[model samples]
Target chain A: MSLESGLNQNKYLNLSSSWRYLTVENFDKITDEELVKLILENQENFLFLVRRYEEKLTRYIRRISGLDKEDIEDLLQDIFIKVYQNLNDFDTSLKFSSWIYRIAHNHAISNFRKSKARPVTVSMDEETEIARRIASGIDVLKEVDQKLKKKVVIDVLKKMDKNYKEVLILKFLEEKDYNEISDILQKPVGTIGTLINRAKKQFKKIVEKEKIDF
Target chain B: MSDLSKNVLEEIKEHHITPKPKWEFLVRDYVIWAMFGILVLIGSIAFSALIFMITNHDWDIYRNLGQSFWQFLLLSLPYFWIVLVIAFSIFAWYDLKKTRAGYRYTFTKIGLANIGLSILLGTAFFYSGIGMKIENIFADNMPFYRVIHPGRGITVWENPDKGLLVGEVTGFIDDEGFNLRDLKNQDWIVSALNSVWPREVKSNIGMIVRIIGKQTGKDTFQAIEVRPWMVNCDRNGAPAVQPCRSLDRERKPFIPFPLIPMPAK
Candidate 1:
């Protein structure tokens, strides 16, 4: 079957020859699932998915691995390629963002394993947001200015265990809820709550142990 | 417009790819969950076997081990089953993490949940007889088990210095003493004037008891301490709450004699 006619007939993309007129603005109009369905028929449509996740995944990899831009790009390319290659296998039950993040998480971990170096903190631009989430009720980091507080958070995250660090990043930095974190990490919600609690405790302990400047 | 996006786009064009098939992911998910279920089952079975070992142990056999009741208990504990339960709990924790949402939970939470789930299932297994049957099968077949198995006349009783006796309270001699029948069906007279009772003592007829003291004669002993034979006092047999060693310390030595009412001196 012709690709355009097939997509139109299947109601997958709900578009046909008119797809040629699709613009960067129109890309955001379509859902990820719909895009995946469209891409299945016309491989060129994969660029839409690529555009959607590229920058987010890039930043995610950098925050988690502290890899250089070049390495992050290489990893991002690999992750996108992986996502494209596995699009047909994507479980519809999960949110598309979560599935993509899961892929990114797995790729970053495997990359870390091969390199055998611990992840370091390289940026704190999002410090204000992270600080707000992490220091929600705790007044320990409250008096510190945004920059120092961010520095403190980064230092503590760098020193903590990988599990604690990942949960902190996902919850506070990524702003993922318990259920979304659960889906991305593939663990039960109860366990996610437990990890976040433990992660907070570990973070506090590290901050106390290191005696970071206020 | 970024060069990296352009590069990724070119790469995509050069190598046409497709997502992995849906069935492969389905198979992977199901396989992980299947493994998790199996681990939970194994953990529960191990726990049930441990419960069976403790619940069904022959307390009367400690009298034959030629050791203090506490020593015999410490030695006969089901270490093998206990280790298996711990190992299986860890495995269950790992396996559960691999499930769709397994990574979100902390290690402590997963470990505790694993144990709690296994015990829940273990209870069913224990009640259904799988736990007891496995233990019986091991005792009946394995040679090593014979060494720890509690029964009548096991060679462990060859020594006569144990000084510990467990039996039924047949009669009350006085406030400081009682008549008893040891596990071996032998008769004995006990004097507990120098002993202490950590918990309340029931001298009701047919009540089982554990006595720690010196053998004063062929059928008599100077009781250093006395306790209810089994702790938690249920109709069905349960392990003793306090064995000899702890009870030995609980006993207050050199208390004033004539614990029973007596005529004025």
Candidate 2:
């Protein structure tokens, strides 16, 4: 299996077609925390964590920031570097994935603020999928063609306030639960709930303004 | 390893970057938590002062002050320390929120923690007498504090023009009244022929009492009601409040050190 297809398939744990420092059987048993311990014990093991998170974080950054692939890679490099530097500071209480995601989230937000950029959907399929998932929360996107639905959702998302837009993407596209969203955003869970509610309202208003049912 | 991972490892080597010493992170975590604890303790001290002031305030003398109970209470509360309790709780909440896992707790959770700890430690401090000691220290050292807090007991008594006088009985005057040295050390003839003793107040030398009535002359105050200065009393006039400090509070030195000396009767 090629790396491109692995990413397209959204197989987060598929280490196939990649360099294997640890055997597949051993890697399956070892968790992210255990990987962190191994990384701390020997800095060389940090590569496993880097490889493991590379695609997932790349997609997340590109999805939230709408940065170019090269820019996303550059951001990913910096993020992993930061993760390596701060391994000692990682709280064991949090899932290691959440911790890394939080770091990535904060860095992306900081980067986006410094350079004013709008979030976007990179691919047509991802756009339609996001619109379909988002539509379930509001109203069903009835007989509208898949192409029109994607365009409408993408336009509404682009027009929404950056905060609401980011939250909606995290909830619908990234599939993070409320608690996970709170951790990533470093907001109170209650605040996240309020943000999501307002985001949905804003989304519905934009959809209505567009006035294309389904 | 992926190329980006290789580059990161290479950068790590070039920069000699290491996972910062575990002690550094540990110390950081401890410092944030220590800061939070210190803020809560300071808030508790403010709470203790609040407790001391509210407890020692003459609650039943609102009628003498010519105001309703709530009016007197509203006017007499220690707003300064109450503001401090709120301010320190926010500071404590912010400090706690700075910790790694701190954001997990909402401000309400942290605020409740701060107030609960403050109430617990504050009541303890009040009972341990630190609260009263703090009140006294502020009362004596910071005269400017007098303008801000002015104090309930002292201010209530300071309004002698409104027919209130707090002082020691210096001498007797033929059953018509007594020679009194007021809080300011001024002399006054307190005429108490038909004065009501409302609460275990005795007209004796060196007994600190609060008198209410009219100022009969420049150097005299006609007493309508006499009450003990410090101790709150039930109908029987026994010591009826907890953390009362001293059963002899009325006779002991108050507001300042060592009882004022008057010529023995």
Candidate 3:
């Protein structure tokens, strides 16, 4: 078959109702790398990959940027488009999830710059969980109730430098390990460790500056 | 698929923006490394020029400039080359930070590394005589260099208080003195009674020599040291006889002085 006819046949096979229950490799069992290879062969299959990431990435963009629904939608489209265009450059050794998050982080940071927004805060539920996580890590904040601690942490994060604040968000809100944070920030794991420690110190200092009786 | 996914996929289909070619990144990396290499080369040249100027300066000949040792150094030091070294080092620091793995190091670390590397390579270049050749090129080409470098030029020896004089030996008066014609062709009796000659120099008639001593008479000088008046020679071993106006030529003060008759004679 000519290349166009072959592509059309693949499209036909993909759209047929039999594809949902087909004997081919299952979507759940296939690795993201394998999915990427399949997508390269037929661009229409990229929708499956996009659907997998859309909800998680949408929430991630919202939490990191605090942009409105429309802006988040626009950024989500841009990030996915960027992911598609640069799919060839992805390193197979890294987890594809980390690479996607890295792209998202970069795009959101750029959006923040464009909008001239300084504050990146988590939702209340996320803040409460992150505050609990911080309390578990640092003993001093452990005594406070989850709500009060979350409020204090949010206040402190709002006032901190972007470098420190981002590490805190990645560590507590996103619950990412040092290596994943390193990949996202393009820094060494040791630097991520240092940044987290420094961020904790700055968090405490900001808490003190605000005269919070923690 | 969700509407968001469908819309994004449709946009990708319409725009068809592909990843940049791998060669573009390779080209970028090559250009960055090339820039770094050029900076290092320029920095090496600047640093070696600095080392050459320092080592080749006549530290022992301060009396010829009518100044104390420190004063002569302050006046004649090659500040231009030193400034060039600093500028190149800064450029190296800025350029190096843009390289892969360069941002991992602190700015001070990068700056110090640049200086340390330059100095190490500069030492090698110094030993290889690239530094000396570069300094010589500047000294020979830039006439104004003597104005900034005080210890250069025959004018330094003209100060009677400095106990330095350049003259051609017209005839030996005796074991203690000689009738000499200064560069300006003025006749003077040079008293070499207590003069020291580190090397045995043939005091042939018509030979030019520099006498470092004090003036004790209207037409006489008391010599403390006597040395041959060396003219700079070119790569072909031929004398590069600079015109009298050229003040920045670098020459050893101890080479054999050729027997050239005084111009006025």
TM-score of every candidate's chain A: 0.82, 0.81, 0.81
Model 1 reproduced share of reference interface contacts: 0.67
lDDT of 3 at A158: 73
* Candidate No. with top DockQ: 2
* Better structure of 2 and 3 per lDDT: 2
Candidate 2 falls in which docking quality class? acceptable
Q: Give one digit per residue, the lDDT tens place, for model 1 in B1-265.
A: 5666666667876775556678888899899888888988988988887887776455655654556888877877888788888898888788887776567667888788888899999988877767765765665555455454432222232222566666777887667777887646788887877687533454465666666667888888776667664334433333332221122221212223335555555
Docking class of 3: acceptable
lDDT of 3 by residue, B107-135 (tens): 67888888888888887876666776676
True-structure RMSD for candidate 1: 12.3
Each candidate's clash count: 13, 2, 1
Sorted by DockQ, highest first, which candidate order results? 2, 1, 3
lDDT of 2 by residue, A112-177 (tens): 777776455445546877787777665434434444466766777778887887788889888989
By TM-score: ranked, best first: 2, 3, 1
Model 2 ranges with Cα > 4 A deviation: A1-21, A24-29, A116-125, A139-148, B59-74, B151-161, B171-179, B184-205, B213-225, B231-265
